[model samples]
Target: MKQGRSLLASGFVAFLLLSLAHSTLRIEPERSDASPTISDPAALLALQTRYRSLTRQLTQLTPSRPYIVVDTARNHLFIKRRDRIMLDAIASTGSGTILDKPGETAGQWIFDTPRGEFSVQSKLVNPVWVRPDWAFVEEGLAVPISQADRVEPGVLGAYALGFGKGYFIHGTLYPRLLGKNVTHGCIRLNDDDLKSVYQLARVGTPIMIF
Candidate 1:
């Protein structure tokens, strides 16, 4: 009978340890200081159109070009034109946490996407993930994981759109996983839609998430 009690205590202790171990995690890597130089006309045109549409939908005001509307609470993005919504698709948000502010930390902790006004600062194609050291130490994980581990698979590698300081609207490997607040701090989107967004948006495009 005593042995049985001991085993139960051991199991409980193990569970707590496991939970603590998983409290912190690293999804990908950090952004670099390099600026993207796009040279494709077709890609540039698409980005312009998308930006025009999204901007129109969000404000219900017509802009001469296309734009994007990101509503974190609704888990949807609207590509609009004039006063009409051209495209409406599911989007995965920041894990329900507010990390856009400076001096904040990153981890596996789940939270909702933050609501605020922001803008697309830049676009990156085949960009490298520069992992943060704080995430490593907090999670009891190693800082600066290997390049192999940093390279996430799927369309995410194809295009990554930066917004504000550290926030981004990027592609995801799991499109079906949209409509949920499940990203570390970035917004996740479908591959096709992301490609379209990538082509239409440019640096300085306004993004309002609420």
Candidate 2:
């Protein structure tokens, strides 16, 4: 319901902006001796009223608690509460590389990290990486026939926060690559930063990525 309202407010805001511009474009001299001025005061007043309504809608939609923001373009993660930033850490995001899907069909998987809002669905300690078929394919190895072969340990470091799908904000073994696009799709931070995030964020904490 909130998302629907947000969309509606956004559309309304756009419409008002366009209407305002159109109104401005339509402005002409009421008299040859007069300076240029607003042609329709009533329409402008209505737009201002709608703008106030939209402002309220936007204010109500703002997050009230601590949230996570991962800037994929800049490789930065911020843990923020309201207007204050609690933590700022260098991070690594998806590589945007593609891997050809194995088989006769023409298919491929892009490694770009997903964008938009998500919430922490789960948390983990001493997380284990269950390798996927892509991992094997990327390494030029055949997909393991047994499911047990996919299970790998000690790769995700001591802490992880799952934010839906298979994506996570987790610690990395290669701390040197903290500020680069190197992961498959997950957000990677150093051990210290990961620990701080793990401790501060709880299940259902909102995460915004772009």
Candidate 3:
């Protein structure tokens, strides 16, 4: 019985040593001390939260009115509806001469389109061009040969106006030379934009110039 007890003790010792060896072989090696820690849970959450807030704010800030701006310097016209631009186009202005007058000789006249805040008092289709007496006098030219004289060839220049009694928004024959402050004081637009505005806008539309 004493010999059997000795053999059992030896077997238990051998089993314990084999188990320790197996555990050591299965263990993974330690990570290098110089390696960076990989955690960024807080930063990821913060970025997501900020993106959502920005998206909501953008949705809430849309505009609700129509705004029109004409930049004489840029020679561009812009019309916006509710913070979004609907029309962007090129336009021409008076030849920097806000007034027209006769030059030193008859048939010689200098003209300048007037600039100011004017309202669109009326819109005309197939508009007729009329020559006023002042236009003749200013150019030192003879009075128009006849009243109701729609006879001046170059006088009309292509478009006519009735804005503010004598001013106008019209088309120009010199389309190539548009985007210039070079008309007889009328605001000139490209044919397409002119048609669009003529159709869309009505009498008494406000126009402010800078």
Best by TM-score: 2
Tens digits of per-residue lDDT, candidate 1, 115-199, equal: 6545567899875565554345555666555766544345455788887556778887787789987777788888788888888
Candidate 3 residue lDDT tens string, 15-89 = 334344444333255567754332577864665565565444433432233333456666665664433667887
Q: Which ten residues in a row have the lowest lDDT in candidate 1?
A: 19-28
Each prediction's TM-score versus the true structure: 0.57, 0.73, 0.54
What lDDT is reached at residue 173 by model 2?
86
lDDT of 2 by residue, 64-146 (tens): 66778788999999987654689999999999999999999788888888987677889999999999989999999999989
Colliding residue pairs in candidate 2: none
Predicted structure 2: lDDT: 0.81
Which portions of model 1 show Cα errors greater than 4 Å?
1-62, 97-112, 134-139, 145-155
Clashes of 2: 0
Candidate 2 structure, TM-score to reference: 0.73
Compute the lDDT of residue 178 as modeled in candidate 1.
95
What lDDT does the true structure give each of the candidates? 0.62, 0.81, 0.55
